[model samples]
Target: MGRWLVLGGTRFLSRAVAAEALARGHEVVCAARGESGAVPEGAALVVVDRDVPGGLDALRGERFDAVVDVARMSYAWVRDALDALAPTAAHWTFVSTVSVYADAAALGQGVDGPLVPRRESGDGATDPEVYGGLKVAGEQAVREAAGDRALVVRAGLICGPGDGSDRFGYWPARFARGGRAVVPDAADQPAQIVDVRDLAAWIVAAGERGLTGTFDASGPRTTLGAVLDEVAAAVGAADLERVPVAPDVLAAAGVGPWAGPSSLPLWLPASHVGIVARDTAPAAAAGLRCRPVADTARAALEHERALGLDRERRAGLSPAEESRLLTHP
Candidate 1:
């Protein structure tokens, strides 16, 4: 068994990572503010807020084989983490986002590309900024802080059990209810999403290999309609007809989904998004490849059910809606 430290251990993806590490026979330690609640059952907990004056020093005493930073965004946070961890950890995995890319709609964007630039002040850029310019800045900050030792992974929309906000899962529940597929023209546009479990596995593998540099970690690129079909098929439903509304019409209704806005027509807004390859070659070369989306989707649905996320939805649906949800059963 190896020793592993996970920062931001209470968040969605971080918790998944911690769970995976423990299952792999690793002694995992989680350090985060108790915001999302206590660390996973077996993980040793070190409650330290990132904003604290001596937060970096709090983790200085312990050593581990690797450290996964799952909640870092600011450059200052990156710098502080590396300074404390570089001395002890053999590998450093920093969870990043695809927003680092300048032009995602274009292709051939290998592991390395021109970033969208960083803002010293977090206020300058946010989740709603122009595309992912802010994430680009965060990636740069991590790169500068860890250099050769840093293993940066740029992930797409992450989804799975313990989903927290029930964003992507909203589609599956809605589809299962067998109502009009309230979709916009963007329904046929490009869409990309990564299962949290696959991402967790890949991170652990990358750490074991000591791989460095940035790499795209995402699922296969497909249209939003294709996503609906695949997920429905995964859940044993396949007779529902998906109807699309005019972009403006959808906009007027004001329903924005995780995949896109109500007006986004076809494949997840292909104009701004295009998921070709996961750019996983660097990470793949490090002995990690994303699991098949089919399997990921199936497991994600199972996990969601196990979490009882559909209880309220199940109760809310009428008998007719429930019958429509059952494509064949």
Candidate 2:
């Protein structure tokens, strides 16, 4: 067992990483504000606010066998962490997004694909271009500091348990409700996602093995229609009926694709279709395994039920919105 430091382990992917590390007999220390939620049961939480100068001063002298940083939108955070602890860490993993790619219209590109222009300043916003730019810059920083010790995971859409996006979870939840459901007419559009648990497990394993280099981390390529079909099959109610709506009709009706309110989750326009069709062969060849979509659906449905299926969501359509689309489209 090794000593591990997780930069933001209080919630979601970071939390799962911390939990996974602890499960593997590693001593895990999670550095965060401790606001999102508690660290996993066995991991220790070291409260540190990254917005302030010297925020990581508490762990300045500490050394870890492995360090995982899931710094979402901040290049400053990435730089500061590296400056503070990169030298003392044996293995470093930086969680980045596939959006870092420069061209979303280019499908099936591997880790060798071109990246978005680097952005040194991270404003902590949700703008996709800005987000991708920051991640590109962050990846550069991690590689600079850790060199061959770095594992950069350019992740695609991540789903399954502990997911808050409510994107993929929407299908299982809505299907389980048993009614006429509105789906995008994109039968052949590419869709790819990695289950949170699987991604976390792979990250831990990579760190343990001192894996280096970049990899596109996602599930095998499949169509959006197939993904939806699997989700419906795994958890749909007996009376569930899927109603497909054309993209143009959805556009004219003011509903967006991909995520957000009144949108069909996982449905992508042509220009952005490549984002979900990335080549994941390298990641899989490096021992990254993905579970069946049906397993993911069941887990997501369970998470949805825990969060209340009827609750307002950060992504996907509201029931009334879906009903209107079903009837009017």
Per-prediction TM-score to the true structure, in the order listed = 0.81, 0.98
What lDDT tens digits, residue by residue, belong to model 2 across residues 1-329? Answer: 89999999988899999999999999999999999989999999999999999999999868999999999989999999999999899999999999899899888998888888999875636689889999999999998999789999999999988887888898999999987888888889999999999999999999999999999999999999999999989999999998888899999988888888887889989999899999999999999999999999999999999999989998888888877877777
On TM-score, the leading prediction is 2
**lDDT for predicted candidate 2 compared with the true structure:** 0.92
Task: Name the TM-score of candidate 2.
Answer: 0.98
User: What is the C-alpha local distance difference test score of each model?
Assistant: 0.64, 0.92
Q: Lowest summed lDDT over 10 consecutive residues: which window, candidate 1? A: 259-268
Clashing pairs in 2: none
Writing each residue's lDDT as its tens digit, candidate 1 over 221-270 gives 66676776676666634555566655554444443434332222223333
Model 1 bad stretches (over 4 Å): 124-127, 130-134, 186-188, 236-239, 257-267, 275-278, 298-329
